[model samples]
Target: MVLQGLTVLNQKNYEISQSIGKNLFDNINEGGFDYVISECQTCKWQIDMSSNVTCIHPLTLLCMSMDA
Candidate 1:
């Protein structure tokens, strides 16, 4: 059987998921999530994106994660 749940990992594992289109399959609007976060490997920065938007990050990245 296929178990369905959100699984978040470190930067390395996150990238692997991105490559395999794992992030594409997530249903962001179906849960208690304001946004999902992932860190940029190249810039050493984190980003938060909602279903209605991309990771523009007008607010602080550290603060966003704290709320999550």
Candidate 2:
């Protein structure tokens, strides 16, 4: 799904995905966790290419033109 020119795929907002995108959504150290997280515990990923505008679609303002 597209959001503000970024392809963010969240379950409540995406068309082909299902997730909240984060684990332990609260401050667990303060008191306790509000809910359980069941995703992979050892998975490490990165978006080095999309760190800038490299992954933005052509329909986005950054990819659009002033005269067109």
Instruction: Count the clashes in each prediction.
Output: 0, 0
Which candidate leads the pack in TM-score?
1
TM-score of 1: 0.27
Residue pairs that clash (backbone atoms under 3 angstroms), model 2: none
Quantify how close model 1 is to the true structure by its C-alpha RMSD in Å.
Answer: 9.5
Score candidate 2 by TM-score against the native: 0.17
The C-alpha TM-scores of every prediction are 0.27, 0.17
Q: Residues 1-68, candidate 2, lDDT per residue (tens digit)? A: 11212233333444321132222112223334332222222211111112211222334533355556
lDDT of 1 by residue, 1-68 (tens): 11111322465466554444434435544445554444443211222321433433435567766899
For candidate 1, list the clashing residue pairs, or say none.
none
The per-prediction CA RMSD against the true structure, in angstroms, equals 9.5, 15.5
Q: Which candidate has the top score in lDDT?
A: 1
The RMSD (Cα, Å) of candidate 2 is 15.5
